[model samples]
Target: MNIFNSPQRKRLFQSMKMGWYNFAPIEEGTGIPLTDQETPYALYYCHQVLPQTIQEIQQASELVGSVLTQVWQIIRTLDEDTLLYYGFPEATIKLVKYDFLAPFCMRLDWCWNQEKGIKKVVETNPQTPSFWFECTDGNNKVARHFGLQEPDLNVQKTLKITLNQHVNRAALNLGKPVTDCRVAFTALNNAEDLGTMRWLRNYLESKSTILPLEYLGIKDGKYLFDQRTKKPIDILFMWYPVEWLIHDTDEKGERLWPALEQLIFENKIVIVNFGSAFALQPKSIFALITDLGYDFFSNKDAGTVWEYFPKTSLSATAIGNSYFAKPILGREGEGGFAVNSGKISVRSSNNDPWYTQQNYVYQELLEFPKLEIDGKSMTQVWGAWLYNNGHDKFISGGVGIRLSEGEITDNLSYWCPIGC
Candidate 1:
């Protein structure tokens, strides 16, 4: 805590504040936000990490390279209306009020490390929540909440460098030789990732054209290059709600948005970040890993993932229960079915009946390795290794971590420095 008095901390805050002032919202004469049609940005991001843990995270880069080759192969061939799974509960939060315009993408929040090896996707963010922002806010909140300075994840360069790795991979994914694609980052579209898209665009500006979505006007069903060309923009990118594009009401009057139906049938835009990648059967991946002799645990049936290998110990069937249900594509502790006091309480959020996964693999909850931070409670820095397709069999760059103060990580939990 004494580190706050140090000059290093002062410089960091000063830099963040400067970026914040430069990128805050704009006001128009009408007293409404003059939404920057092309770019909407916020600079409330700071980088921090645990050096030793970050080193391991860096090693996880190899997994990104390994997985994306397989991931891209899967996406390139799949139809637009394909379905994927969300391993984390927060991902469900993003789909809480899904729309066609902001329909989900192939957002994955898997942990990669030397110990767990490749494709160790325990959970995912709700469309890749920006940990850098969470790290920034976490630092501010702790300081205010407790009236005491806490170690900030931003204290370590791991924060910026790790995010730099993720975006760099995304840029590489959409870079030249891959159809000369351009990026169009949308706020609240891909949720936290919209902030990340700008960071990625800055990195990509040197390699290729990084155009904000506004530059390529989206009209009717297609992204028109211009009124004159009107052929349709080739590259399609968004982090917005799917509902904005289309929505239909069911007999129960509950609004439902089928983004997959629209994206596949409506246009020819190249959509990366394929949602859920639910089509990739966990059973197959598990078999591959097991065939290779890896010792990780995974449930094959989506019906009973909650009975075993559930997201958190809290979600596990109370001690002796033999039956539990879970969404096939559940993530971040959402859509759980726990057997409580001889009662099966299945939790689900916005999972469309059409795409609801029914498979389940039940297994005992895993004892996720823990990291103990000095002056901080037990923290598990969940690693996210971002991979670009077609570079090599190795993950593109460094990794990101979701630090938590509790047993199960949720809501972009705050993380802090371990060494200092």
Candidate 2:
């Protein structure tokens, strides 16, 4: 049965304003396009998962969060080879020394098949995870149009609480008054990233500002500043990947690592979703934890990891012939591929260039359960945002769905709101 309504699509297009993108009408019987003119995402569908599945996902997420905390504790103890394998450059090893604390905000993406009873996590983004506005604001709009109601999880409200608490703690640690703290939320200049930063800045407590990555720089030797205003940034809410920052070079071909090192070591500025995010960004954490055995995780946490994390190996060829190849640090289905009959079948459209230089890990290839929409077979990837409030509290902010026609979810995948 088709759940899409034309009137609803018109309302979403007019009200949501997904930033200049048009949601083209979904053609009846044909699969939803990667994009459409009438909505920022494929509008005709809002996927639903069993309430039991949502409960289980939250449980698994907490377990994974605990294990990740353990991994952070032992990160420095890992041999140089293991550390380097996860893409930590030689110069950045010092940053890993402060790993007792984990990032406050995170998202875990999973491929769950109900009929086959398969639920495997693809990756975890400890620091910068998008889809907040889409999931909380846009998804709710869509749900109401479909006469659906989700229990009052209130994702955006939860995010505000998480951000407010983290910012307050950061202010305290920096010896700065929360009232005087000037925080900057920064991301790349791209539309999607900037949009996310904008959305976050709206809810951020304290005096907050938003800027593009290009406008951020180190000034006066040790202070992280906004190049646009020449003002020092007291706290930074960075959506940009930290690994890239560690490798950043100036116009003169000099690595900027020294400037960042000083800023961090001197505590000139506090960064939210701390540098520990780098340690969890790579897919190898799952592999390492699995190889290190259940000793690294509590018995229950260990079971969750084994059950939800697919067998991941550093080498793509090691996981038999029909595994999925994924960059250790890839995002948004980029640098990912599926192998069948010794041939690469599916490749991510948004594969990052940096991933080409990094190692790839292979995991067992599991198919996603399909849902028929408008006579088109569609699949979805379930993403749940896990926010650690920096106070030993793990909150499942909410869940969102990425709908796609292809085997791999990519940048253009539509946001399908989940409802009970």
Candidate 3:
């Protein structure tokens, strides 16, 4: 039975096409397109999990968030040389040191082997985590279509409150009311990135604007401005990755990143997912935490690290076989590979030199629960979101599931909604 060609699958696709799921079109710049016969992006299916599994995932996400929070605290106190060793670009070191608070939102990628009851977090995306629309509204629509109960029903509400609260706090910190703040949301010109930003911008209760990354510029090396409106932006909520943002240049190839960094450092502009969040984006942070050992962490945090995090090292050879090698600043599983029995088994096709040329971290590989979809086996990776509720408190926002044909969940992974 080919599920993709089934009647239910067709109906599900139609429902998604007519609803808020904007990433369905093959030519919409949402993601990598597939052959005409296959669904290019989201799967017209919902994967149901036990209520206990949902609770466990939420609890584990909060614990991992705490450990990362502690690590970020230590990272902020480190000197330049130490930060450079951990893959922080020297150009943005000063900006990363001037901390604001924990990132407003982050997503931890996890591999959950239900049969073995093992959940291991692989990496953290603190800078620009996507799938916001897919996880909340899209998940609800998919669950309703299948006549199943949506897990985390209040996720949309929670996200609205969290985002608005963060905006209000940023406004207050800037010595202005929320109504007076000009919050600009920018992203590359693409469906997925723009859609995610637009979705998030709608939840913001402050005065807000949306524009493409190209329209954002710096003036007089003091503040970032929207080129279109010719007005200085106060708060920037961008989908651009910090690692890449450091290298941004103007039309004449003059580097503008330094000025942008300076603006944040001088308190001329506020960046959500603050500049310091870059300290948490590197894959090497995992290796750094593991190397720090039990003595560096509180007893409870040490236990959390050992229980939830995969053993990571700066050297692939140190992990021997059965390890995953990932570039320190890799995004969307780019420049990553897996070794099995001392032989390279799975590797990402995206050999983007920007990521491939960077340092790599080797991590112990964990088993991923598999499912048969449309007559092919797919590996599942669960994404748990961590949100900061404006009071230095961390909470699990929600969970989303991505399925891929290979071990690596890349840009083309299917967005399979989760049901309780």
Candidate 4:
């Protein structure tokens, strides 16, 4: 049966367009339409995983997250020279040194080889990780359409509770009542980002405001203000990356980030994930972990690190022939290249020169297990969300799956819903 032509599929697409899932059906700026005949962002069918596999993935995700959390802790104590060695900009050094609360949410991208029983986390996004609506509500909607149970039914519920906990913690730390706190969620005025902001804002139990990044203003080099309302922002929940924020400038090309950083340093305003989250944003941390080995991690954690994390290094020659060279702070596969036998095999189609200018880390390549979906062979990358429960522990919120025909999974990759 042609699921795309089915009545149920039509209704599903219509509902998605009507904001039932808060998913952006089109890629911004490119005008590329998704969930359509050409793109098919969400597949018509569902992939079912065994319960044991789900549990294993979740367990591995949490363990890896704990290890990375320790890595962040160590990174916070490093000096400016060492941080600069790890590709951190000089503009961000002060902000990264601040001892802020744990990240509210993070996502670990993993590649699994089922036949060999191997699961490895490729990279971690501690600052901003999207696909909130697709993995939770959208996945359930697709599962129901196919008469299959959604994987992790309580994912949304757990995330909402976790978000509230983080908000309350932030408010308490600022010595402000929850009702008196003014939380502003800001993102670029793009479809995906704005939609993600709204989806997360809906989960919050307190009153919050949503605005674009451009609407933010610096007042007297002390505080950040919402230009639209001309009111001071208390707690900022932004989807903007700290790396990019440091490079942001006003219309006259004057850098506006230093003032913003000053606001954070002075405790005038607090970002949700905290500015120090940028310490873990660089891919060089992977190489650092591989280098330190037992010196940095405990005997047990060192074993886990060696087993799960691929061998990575700053020099390409350090990691033998078949490896991937990726920009330290690149997102969505930008400026990533796969080198097989000392030659570039596949490069990201969405490569941006800005990222290429940054430092690159060479990581051992892991082959992704492929599946035949709708007559197309697709490789899969599993994303696991890690939430800090405010008790010095990281918990698995849920999982999101993406599929791509290419070696590198980028923004153009299809979001494949999972069922159990």
Candidate 5:
């Protein structure tokens, strides 16, 4: 059946025409105008998953979180030479020694083909989980339009609660009242970054302010300040990836090292998705956990880890056959390639200019479930957005589905809404 032909689909399109969902790109030089840019209509139908599936996903997410937490603990024990091999800079290694917020927001990408009978984790973004705007608001609007029911789909409510909880915990660390805490949310001036921040700012306007990330500076070499007002920022929520910032340099060709690091070490600023979370960005960590076996994990966690986690390793020879190779810190499918029978079948053309210096990992390949959408057979990848309360405890925020004709879900993949 063509799901898009229903009355609900037409109503959703009408809502789009009525500007119920609008987007504005942040950059003018990118050629994408500040206008709405002919917004795409969200998926007309909701994709439903069984309750058991949801439970298993949540369990798997928590297991991933646990393994990563242990990885952090293990990193601090490694020598400097070993740390550099794991893609950590001397500065970042120091940050790992301290107890910091991890995975304040994250997403685990999973693929499950019915014939396989198990969901395999494809990748993880433990720092700066994007797509909050679409997953929370757009998903609900689509669900309501289709009269679908999903008890765990209230993402906006969960986001608000989680943000508040994170900020409150930061306040305690700063020894300040939660009401007196000053917060700012920042991202690079790209369309996705800005739009996501704008949507979140709209929801958090009453509690915090939105500002440019460039406004950050150090005062008198002893304190961190918001350059706009030269006032010290108490807490910050960054949409930019922590790894990128670690390698960034100022316009004068000077490295931006230790400006953020010093602030965090001195307790002058509380940054969400804390610096330590960078440990989870690489694919090699999955292989590390896999090699450790189920001895360290709980019964459920052990089973989930073995079932969902893919066979991954830091070396290509470790992957005996068809596999996927990806940069440890790549984003949006960039610097990634699909290898079939030890030959490169597909490679990403969208490599980021800044991420050229990272190491790569080879992972076992898993097939995505085949689904029919818009008169075409497409591969579906489900992303479970997970939030960590800064204490290794994770809560399921919501789910986002991306479909594409190709095997890899890149920046061009379509966002399909989920139903009950």
Candidate 6:
């Protein structure tokens, strides 16, 4: 079923203003109210639970570190080319495919007071895990009780620094005389992954000059080279659709991709394209999964699980993302659907790649997990992670709660941060 098209969704949208924080609809401007009942409620709930959540996730982080250590050891012993197939160069790429830590961050968060003392993960917006819009809606509620600043994504500093290091590296590579290159930039068009892209850009541009490409027209298919000084346009940190570069083959059988490829390849413009590379997605991931277990259904094999998920309606090609529409790469929940040879198919991105022969069991739909706030259905949690180029660590950052009456987990969710 199309979760967005459901009558349930109507109820969900109606509650958007009040759902995430239990904040009153009137809390938008005029400064936060003093008697807001939502403030005490949100704090009480977070205080009661966040402490324990933090401890558990810290342990989970260590577990992931250990697992990566072992996986790296074993995988490194493989054939040279085999190692590359697993995205050794692009850590996030390999990570987005089979890892769950980054994903868990967006979905979970808590505070820890053990050896760290009041440490907390602010967010985990791993994918399109966006909250800026919701951040605006809930600002008054947060400011009233929580005392947070407006237009905040509630991101953590560790994550902010980690991402900035990458941007700074690109800037340095652009041979900056300090003022020659801008640190980061964002787009106005809010695509699916646009939220995550913006977070990193803002984080990287922290204390740096960041101008939108549209603001300067510096990105209109032009080089950064100074026509007068003969200096190429310095590093341009951008997070745009990869589609822009390859919209179509050009007049001479070339594509815009080649231009971007040249810019990036030649290091003419230092860029961090976050959209297309949100995570490591290899075309071979599905086939690699099939070799490990469950018969990854093609259009020919989709009837097997199409009923479990329905929103996925892409006509999968052999070499594109459709290949990941199987049950191995990752979890697509019960909504994403795709088309096969002659029929429609349902698949998930959360394919485990390898499972024992009898370790898995296919079951019917079970009851949905209920998470209520103030006697109303409202809330979703998105975990965030960072694949730092500097320390090369996947530091789990924060958790964002998206509120909706129906929590099937989709675009219409509301985002709220955890604390003071």
Q: In terms of TM-score, which candidate is stronger, 2 or 5?
A: 2
- Angstrom error at residue 413, model 4: 0.3
**1-420 per-residue lDDT for model 1 (tens digits):** 343234544455455442221122345434333335323122123334345554544444334334433443443343333323222222222322222221122223443333543324444333343454433343554344334443334323433444334334444443444334443444432223454455444433323333333344435443434333344444444443332323445446644334333433344444434333332323223322222222222222232222212232223343355433444443444344445456655444434443345445332333344554435554354543343323333332334444455545544344332221
Q: Cα-based RMSD of the predictions, in order? A: 10.8, 5.2, 3.1, 2.8, 3.8, 13.4
Off by over 4 Å in 6: 1-48, 58-129, 132-155, 175-180, 190-233, 241-245, 248-255, 273-368, 387-389, 416-420
Model 2 Cα lDDT, one tens digit per residue, 40-140: 56465555556787778777777667767777767867777768876566666777766334578788888878788988887888766477666566666
Candidate 3 per-residue lDDT over residues 95-139, each given as its tens digit:
777866567888889998878877799999877747777776777
| Runs with alpha carbons beyond 4 Å of true place in candidate 4 | 1-10, 13-38
Candidate 4: worst 10 consecutive residues by lDDT? 17-26
Position 315, candidate 2: lDDT: 68
Least well predicted 10-residue stretch by lDDT in candidate 3: 17-26
Model 4 pairs in collision = none
Top model by TM-score, which number?
A: 4
Candidate 5 residue spans exceeding 4 A from truth = 1-45, 48-52, 151-154, 201-206, 298-300, 352-357
| Alpha carbon lDDT at 116, candidate 5 | 70
- Which pairs, if any, clash in model 5? 46-419, 47-419
Q: How many clashes does each candidate structure show, in the order listed?
A: 52, 10, 0, 0, 2, 41
The runs of at least 3 residues in candidate 3 whose Cα sits more than 4 Å from the true structure, single-residue gaps closed, are: 1-39
C-alpha RMSD between model 2 and the true structure: 5.2
Candidate 1 lDDT score at position 2: 40
List TM-scores for all candidates, in order.
0.49, 0.87, 0.92, 0.92, 0.85, 0.48
